[model samples]
Target: MSGDGVFSSGVLSCLAALQRLMDGNPTVAQHVGLHRAKITAGIVSVEAGFDRGYLKKSRPAHLPILAKIEAARRSSVSSSISSTSSDVKRLKGKLRLLEDELATVLTQRDKVLTQNIQLWERVRELESAHRNSNAPELTTLT
Candidate 1:
């Protein structure tokens, strides 16, 4: 698909060349418009010549497997994207629940601390009262 000169890729160039060859537009190919003669000549040259290796007619056999491989790669990418998004949603939900529990625990801890302070103050008052009641009266000297 690159415009990197006419014959950059062999068959790739031939495909673009084919369009021009068939159009018969003078602007496209000047005078060498899609002649049945030229196409037949090219086909004959390819067939009669002994240059039979990669560019032969047998390569069409690979198209089906190629299509399947492309489909599978697309499917895997889409599934991975979905799974990653789901994991993020799950983590967000867990984070919210944990934050709620932490707040409740903090509130309960503050209440317990306040209760302990009040109990300590009551204990100090009770102990002082007991000492005062047990103390001997300051009687006048006889």
Candidate 2:
């Protein structure tokens, strides 16, 4: 059966999906089913022709439609994987840049804090010197 002009199971499964779609249409379901039967009959007729030597060929035709579909699916999956990898790399680079920016801002904050502390200490020293210079002077009793 595999070597004959019969469709693979996968092709039949696809046809079943189409049948499900047709079943949902209440008005045209019967007509669609009839149409599908007619199409199946046509395919069988063609297969019979090929079998009876009505159609001569050097080699039998191999309709690997399902295999082709699977290959396309695999190609799409690989493409999406590569796209996701690039997106991750881009996000990591942005994160690194943000971290560097944060470090620079923190360094600037520490420098400003140090300068403020030094300025406050100088003010205290000046006040202490002023108070010491304003003390009462000792006078000579002659």
Candidate 1 residue spans exceeding 4 A from truth: 1-59, 135-142
What tens-digit string does per-residue lDDT give for candidate 2 at 37-95? 23232232233332322221232332343233344446656777898999999999999
Residue 95 CA error for candidate 1 (Å)? 0.8
lDDT of each: 0.52, 0.50
What TM-score does model 2 achieve against the real structure? 0.45
List, residue by residue over 42-118, the lDDT tens digit for candidate 1. 33223323122323344454233334334544665677678889999999999999999999999999999999999
Candidate 1, residue 32: Cα displacement in angstroms equals: 58
How far in Å is the alpha carbon of 42 misplaced in model 1? 36
What are the per-model numbers of colliding residue pairs?
A: 0, 0
